[model samples]
Structure formats: structure tokens, C-alpha cells
Target: MTTWSAPIYVYLWLAGMAGGSYFAAFLAERFAGYNQRRLTQLAIQMGVLPAVLGVLLLLADLGNPLRFWHLLAEFNILSPMSMGTWILLAWVAIAVVMNVLYRYEGQHGEPGGRPIHRLNGGLGWLQFLFSILLMSYTGVLLATSNRALWAGSALIPPLFVASAVSTGIAVLIAYILVVAPVTTGKTTEYRLPARLLTGSTEWAIPTRLVGRLWEAEAIVILVELVVLIGLVAWLGSSAMAGAREALNMLTFGALAAPFWVGVVLLASIVPLAFDMMSPGKELARREVFRVALASSVCVLLGALFLRAVIVIGGQL
Candidate 1:
């Protein structure tokens, strides 16, 4: 067996998680009316770190990190990595702006109350748009690679999106549960206090919004599984069976546990079950938190495994 460096895969996983976390946090804050200050703050803070690290890892993997300026000095729209670099830079800028706005709003209490909130609302939409692009670009970056398995596959972007959504939900849910009392100032009530006390005619909206995002991600996961299986079957039957066999080293060999258990069963199936069963009621709070946290960790692991398997499989 030939050995290979796998830091790039790790970087990809981290970047995807960061992007997804940003997307989830932005959407949850915008649509759900969920108001845990620490939750949003933590998400914003943690989300940027991975993207920065991923970029650094990419540079390091290139054997000369200093040469990174070449990407910007000489732009190439045709290159996915080049495109990804620009997209990532743009996303970093947006995240910084959102962070500043968030802090400013907290300190200043929104100009004239409603007008400042309105401006924040506009900025919130921009944040969400950029977050989605940040998450989607990871897939686009991989899909742009000339590698046969990664190239020209419609399913890759969606799969990456699904993975992002899954991990994003996970990170948000974990943060909410971890810092619930600090944000809500009530340790006893399991339901998000932000929803109940806000009185905005939009109570329980964030929970429902999160639930819907989870459901959409689950659907995408199903589609991804189907596509991956179909590709394996088709490759096995065609002259590219050797390539298919190497890929199966992921499914049936080394990476099987993570692929089946973490990705398929834990990240996708289990979350779908909980999401379908949970009602936006205080009674279901414990169960909702439990499932969300569990699935989020599983999805994070699955995302890592997905990249690891692909990079390793390709080298094989």
C-alpha cells in the first residue's frame, strides 16, 4: 500500500463544518426567533476558525505555504481551487461583518430601536446568503477536481450541502444545549426560552425552522446514498471495475463503520426519525435536544469520514 498525506482531507472536513455551522447559525437566528446570544456568538466565532485553518492546510499541503499569494496575484476563474479561495475570502469578510454587527447591536441596542433592528435584519439576510455560498463552495471545489470519481457528478454538491447542513445542525444544537442556561438565564426549562418570552408573534419559529432544515438535509442524504450506491453498481459493471473496487474499500472495507453507522444511520436516519416525531412543545424538549446533539456529532464524524475515504480511496 502506498502512503499519502491526508491533511487536505482533514482541512476539507473542518472547512465544511465551519461553513455549515455558519449557515445553520445564521438561518436559525434569522428565521427561528431563537435567541440564545451565546449560541449565535459561539457559532460565529467557531465557524471562521476552521475555514482559516483549512486554507492554511491547503497551503501547507502545497509544500510552499508562502506561495499562496500566487493564487490571488494571478487569478484563474477556471480553477475550482482559485474560485474556492476567492469564495472563502469573501465568506471570511462577511463573517467578520456579521460578527461586528452582532456585537454592535448588542452594545448599542439597535438605532431608534426598530430601525437598527431593520438594518440588522437586512445584514442578517446578507449573512445567510454568504454562509450558504461558503458551505456550497466546498463541494464545488471538490467537484472541480479532475479526478474521475469527484468530477462532473451532480450529486457531489448536494451531498456536500447535505453534509454541511447536517454538521451545522449538530454544532448549533450542541451549542444551544451546552450554553442554554447562560443564554436563557433559566436552567430548568428545556425548551428554548428565547422562543417563549420574545412575544414577537413568531414564537417557536426558530425551532420549527431548525426542524425543517434538518428534514431537508435528511432528504438530501437519502438522495446522496442512492447516487453513491448507483455509481458503485455502475462502476462495478463497467470497465472501470478496478476503480469501483478501490472505492468499495471505503464501503465494504476500512471506512465501512463510519460510512454506514455515522453517515447513514446516525447522521441521517436517526435525526430524521427524531425530527419527524418531535412537536414544538415544551414536553418534547428533552428528546429534541438529545436527538439533535447526537445526530450533530454523528454528522460531524460522517463529514470527516467522507473526505478521508475519498482521499484515501483515490490514492489506492
Candidate 2:
């Protein structure tokens, strides 16, 4: 019997996405400084929404949203399901707190005062750690499972983590593109405030800030592609008959269309091409954002399809 349905597949994807975007933004906050302030704010603003949505989906998958608390009340060190439940619960709770902190800063803070709270620095680290764990938990669950497609596969965890970061970067880039205007409008339009992060302002592009997101996104995309290829190879050559069957299903059988088109082409090759060929610094500011928006949309679509293949393929 299939243990997970389509909703579960979607839940897994959204959960990883939430973790990735939140983690990357805070990480950039540390390295990119004030230039990336909007990135951090937007990331925090977005981080919790998906997580909340994923949780609702999870409850729906359970067939009894009201009984979710029963699962929370128990612990099973031996069960991946048990551990995933707690990790997700903690991740969502932390995200809520972090989001509230960011909102509070946006509304009550002075024009020139400190933007983020020192307490959030500590919370941010915790959030970062949990995000990594949350992303990895999905793969770890599969790798430890009895299914021939997932069992004993070492690449699964890193593959998921890389995809999470890749998708996360896409989300932030898309958010930046929409929130921060690049048109040569009046200075007041900048959301990247001279003192705060806004949607309309920066007459000149923050090339370095955008560059950081791009470089990181490209690197993770490459890593995900490598791991994905390695995973296919590993499964194809496995001694297990079930593993080999799963490989065939993915490579040339029923799952081939989604795996090849959605995961391989859309997720890895095409998006990588567009994302890396980013508009140059001399390019018109509006054009730069256009490319980013395209990349983000492609990456998100690919990510959703990736989990669909993984979850469904494993069962087959």
C-alpha cells in the first residue's frame, strides 16, 4: 500500500522550500551586510508562509487534522515519521517567532536605528540550523527507508539540501525582483531604503548583493545536478532488483517524462543556463530582474516536479 499520497509529496517540497529560503537570507545577512537588508527582511517575511501551508497539507494528508496533536504528544526514536513530525513542528514554531520579530522591526523601529534585534541573531542561528536539519530530514527519511529506490542511497540527503538551497535562492531573487524596483523612477520609490530595505529606491543596482545570491544559487544548482546524476547512476547499478527497476521506471518507463523533463531539463540544465547567463552589470536594471524572475519561476516548477518524481518513484 502507498503510505504517502500526492499531498504528502507537495508537503515535502514546500517544507524544504521554507527551510531553504529562510536559512539563505539569514546567512546572507551575516556576509552581505546592509546592502542585503531587504533580502533578509523579505526572506524572513516569506519563510513562514510556506511552512504554514505545508503543515496544513500534512494535516490534510493525515485524514484527521484535529488529531495531529496526538502525533506530537508521542516520540519514537526509532521512527523517521516521528522525528520528521517534531522537526517540522519546531521549524514552524521558530519561523513564526522570526517572522513576528521582522514585522515588529518594520513597524516600530526608527528610521536610522538598528533594524534587526540582537536576540534575533541568536534565533537566526537556531533557525539556520533547523532549516538545514529540516531539508535533510526529508532525504534522510527516504534513504533510511526499506524501498529499493531510497534505501542505502548516500546522495539523497545532499541532493535534497542542494535543491532546497537552490529553490530558496530562487524565491529570494524573485521576491527581490518584485519588491525592489529598478526603474529610474523618483528616489522615493526605492524599497531598499537609504536607511531601510524597501521595494523602490536603489537607482543603481546593488550588483554585489544580487551577485551574492546568483553565485550561491549557481553553485547549489551545479551541486544538485551532480548529485542527481550520481543518484541515477547509483540506482541503475545497484545489486537490488527493485533498485534497478526503479531506475528503469525513471530512465525509460512511466516516470521518464517527469524525471527527464521536469527534474533533469527544467531543474538542472535549462535553469542553470538562464540563471548563470545573468544580465551583466552594464545591462539595464529592469532587464536584470527579468532574467532573475524567469529563473526563479523555472526553478520552483522544477523543484515541485522533483519531489513528485522522488515520492512517486520510490513507491513504484
Candidate 3:
């Protein structure tokens, strides 16, 4: 298999993040009641912006942004490239639709009800389906390759999916902490006590919402941790000599710093620890914010570091 450039790895990672963010938001929208609409809407809003950036980066990587449509001009079911191209295109379209409908709901609809659009259910399913495909595609793109480290690896898809979702949650947490406080718009029916907004309380958003998202993120990180270890063990036990060597590189070799410090310590363990200790009905907001900020920064950095290790290690 040909070595992919840094842009390719980033493209795959960012695309997964974009999709995963929408997936997390979509679930919030679907299951949570209408009162939490603000949170869900904000989370939903996170998807399109990153997706647009990821697409633009991909176009730039192709050397001529205009020629991107050529990718859509073919349909090769047997090719991972073809599958990814169409999946992202469709995922972007679905995200745009979801955003448009959400905005419309915000502007001209009953304040205390779920989105009234008739196609909402169908559109949501598409969003959910495509997000899963997009997240899985990132890892599949690598695994289907002939590279010894990735060829027979069965865990990359699940690993990437879990990590993508956790990072998506991190993005939501970071954004809400920094941006939601200053916003004056009353777009949803959800209301916070004056204490929460006035800095007297321990929370920025409601306790239930914050608790659920943190819990979800922590759970996904644990799953990712398990998958990561399993991937390492799989590589260690591989028949191919290169695969075993790749495992060593991740554990105690050239790539060890990023793998251990960046991914294991910062990304998984540190964030997981913070998340598991999530405050209950009362705690200092700054304390929670600090922990969240640290976790978010760590997860985002760890994600990039992980892909770097995987991509560069595969080549080595």
C-alpha cells in the first residue's frame, strides 16, 4: 500500500469528528425532551462547521479544489476511496438539512415541542446512519490496505468510532463553557437558574445534561481504552514480523512517547479519570471547567497524536 500523507490522516480524523459530533447531538435531540433543545441544537450546530472545514481541507489536499466532483463521478463499491467519498458527501448533505430544519424550528415553531417538521424522523435516521458510516469509514480506509500493521486488524473501526464520539463530546463541553455564557439568544425552552449563569452555582448547564454527556464520554473512552489495548495485543500476536515490530514501536520504541503519553495518559486515562469524577448537584463551576478544559485539550491532542502514531508507524 502507498503511504498516505498527513493531510489524508487529518482528513479521515476530522471527518470522523464531524460525523461523530452530529451523531452525539442527534441522539440528544432524539431521546431527550424538548426542554434540552438548546443543548442539542448547539451540539448539532457543531457538526456542519467542522464538516465544511474538513471538506475544504480535503479539496486543498487534492491540489485543485474544483476537481472534487470527479470523485463523485464514479461508483466503485469495491473501493474504500469511492465508499468514503460518497459517504462524506451524503453525510454533509444530511447535516446541512438537519441544521436548516433546526434553525427553522428555532425561528417559527411552538417553543415547548419537538421539531414539528414531518421529515424530521427520516432526516434524523439518515443523520444517525451516515454518521456511523463516516466514523467507521476512517478506520476501514486504513484496514483494507495491505499494510502489515493494518491489514488483518479488526479493531480499528470500533476504536476510531469510540474515540471520535468521545472527542465530539469534548468539543461540545468546550464550546458550551466558552461560548454559551455570553450568548443572549433565548432559542430554546431550557432555562438555567440564575446561580448557574451568575457564577454562584457549580454548573454552567443543568446538572442532568452535564452529567449525562460526561458519563457518555467516559463510557466511550473506556471502550476506546479496551479496544486500544486489544489492538496492541493483536499486533503483538500477529504472525507477520513487521506487525509485532509495529506493536513494539507503539509500546517502547520511536512512537512510544505519543502512544503512551499522548494517547494513553492524556487522551484516555486522564480524561477518563476526570469524567468519572463528575460533580453532582453542587461543585465549583471553575473546577469543573478546568477539568473539562484539560480533558478536552487532552482528547483533541491525543486524537491527533494517535493518528500520527498509527500512520507513521505503519510506514516504519
Candidate 4:
């Protein structure tokens, strides 16, 4: 019998998203050049809410939320849950501080902003590392359960990480489209704001930034596809009956519809197709936002359904 509940499923999903957001933001800051500040700010903002909520949910699921502090009082290096609790506590503090600093920098316009920005950047790296650990921790927690569906293989962590990244990129893309200013002309258009975190810059900068983000999202989607395939293949070849049973449940059993319709098609394939056919590159700025918005919605839905199917299906 399964002991986990809906809250657990949601907790897993939110935790992964939070981790992925931080990792994505860190990457944007490191490689996105002028766009780093905006992405970093967006990433941190995106991460903190879900993360804090997820942690709260996890604690609530314990029946007495305050009991979570017990884990902190009693340290156990060998316990995944204890470690995760500590990590969550640390991440929440860091995320809150980062958000406050980022908002201050943006509003005040670089009065001693350089040092603060650098400090945030340093913290971003910590977030990046913690995010990966957090992503892996969810799977590790499941695997530690000794259930054949989860414990039969070590691939769950990698698969979860890949999906988390793809979902994170989808979220950022959606956010950019929703929040960024839109510019349209006869032949060229831009979807991001003219003035980013550093202040008013040329339109060309954000244009290039969007292009890079699009390309990055595409790459992450491709990677997710590959990882999903590999996970299935590994499960198929597993000698454990439990593993094979879990695989069957996911592929052709009660959960098949969601796995196929939500995870494989809507989340992965649809977005890929939309990216290839998006008119945003042309004069259709509206079309671009529409496509991005649609894909992001799909990815987010798929991610939620993916977690639901996996958690519930495993028990079934």
C-alpha cells in the first residue's frame, strides 16, 4: 500500500521546479551576458515562492508542521529526509535574501549595486548547487522507499533532473512573454523589455537575449526527450519484476493516457514543434507570444500530470 498522498506529489513537483528555476537562472547569469540580471531576478523570484510553498506543504503533510523542526534538532547525515529539510531551510533563507537584494538593486539603479550583484551571483551558484541536490533528493527519497517502481533503478534522479530543467525553461519562456514588453514593426520585432535590470539599453540586446533563451529551451527539451527515452529503455530491460511492473503501468496500463498525452506529446513534442514553427522570428509578435504562452501552459500542465501519474501510478 502507498503511504504518500496528493501533497507529496505536489511537493515533489514544486521542489523540482524551484530547483530548476535556480539552476536556469544561474546559467542565464553566467552565459546570458546583458540579460543575466533580468533572468537572474526572474529565476530567483520564480524559485522562492514554489520552494517555500512546497516546504510548507511537506511540513503540513506531516500532521504537525512544527514537527519539522525536530529534524533540524536531531541531525542525521544518513537520513535523506533530514538532509532535505536542512537544504530546504537554507534555500528559503537564501532565496528571500536574493529577492530582496535584487529588488533593491533594480529600484535604486546601482548605488553600490556592483557588490550586491556579485554577492547575489555568488549566492546564485549556491542555489544552483542546492537545486541539483534538491532535484535529486526527491527521487532519492522515493528510491529509499525500497519500492520496485522507484528503487529498482538509479535513473530516476537523472530523469527527474532533465524534466525539471525542461519545465524550468518553459516557465521562464512563459514568464518572459507575459512580463516583457512587446515591440512590433513591419519586418522585425522583440518580445523582451528595452530596459532590463541594468537600465535602458539598445533593443538589439534583448532581441539577442530572447534568441539565446529560445535556443537554450530547445536544447533542454531535446535533452529531456533523450532522458525520457533512456529511462523507459532502462526500465524495459530491468530484470526485476517490480521494475517491469512499474514500466508496464506507465507505458500501457491505467496511467498510459497521461504519460502519452501529457508528458510525451503535450509537454515535449508540441513545444518542440511550436518552436520550429513559431512566427515570432518574423513580424508576428502576437503569434510569438501566443505560441510561447501555449507551449508554456502545456509544459506546466504536463509537469503536474507527470508527477501525479508517477506518484499515484506507482501505488496502483
Best-fitting candidate, scored by TM-score: 2
> Which model is ahead, 1 or 4, in terms of TM-score?
4
Positional deviation of residue 15's Cα in model 1 after best superposition, in angstroms: 1.9
Candidate 4 clash pair list: none
Give the Å error, residue 259, model 2: 0.7
Which pairs clash in the backbone of model 2?
A: 179-199, 189-200, 190-200, 190-201, 191-198, 191-199, 191-200, 192-198
Q: Which digits, one per residue and each the tens of the lDDT, describe model 3 over residues 1-316?
A: 4256677767777887887776776686467664434554555557777777777777887866788898889999878878988998888787677667755654564553254555655776777888889888888888887777776678888888988888787787667655544333532122333232222322235545655776787788899999999998889888976888889888999889888998899889888888766545122355665777677778877887777777777778
On the 0 to 100 scale, the lDDT of residue 165 in model 3 is 89
- Off-target runs (Cα >4 Å) in candidate 1 are 1-5, 27-43, 112-123, 182-220, 230-234, 237-243, 270-288
TM-score per candidate: 0.76, 0.87, 0.85, 0.87
The candidate that achieves the highest lDDT relative to the unseen native structure: 2
Note the Cα lDDT for every prediction shown: 0.62, 0.76, 0.72, 0.74
Pairs with steric clashes in candidate 1: 32-206, 170-296
- Give each model's clash number: 2, 8, 0, 0
Model 3 accuracy (lDDT, Cα): 0.72
After superposition, candidate 2 runs with Cα above 4 Å error: 35-37, 106-116, 185-207, 279-284
Model 1: weakest 10-residue lDDT segment is 195-204
- Model 3 ranges with Cα > 4 A deviation: 34-36, 63-66, 111-116, 182-205, 279-284
What tens digits encode model 1's per-residue C-alpha lDDT throughout 160-277?
7667766766666665555442324432332334323232222122444445655655665676567667656654555543556555666787767766776667656676676556
How does candidate 4 score on lDDT?
0.74
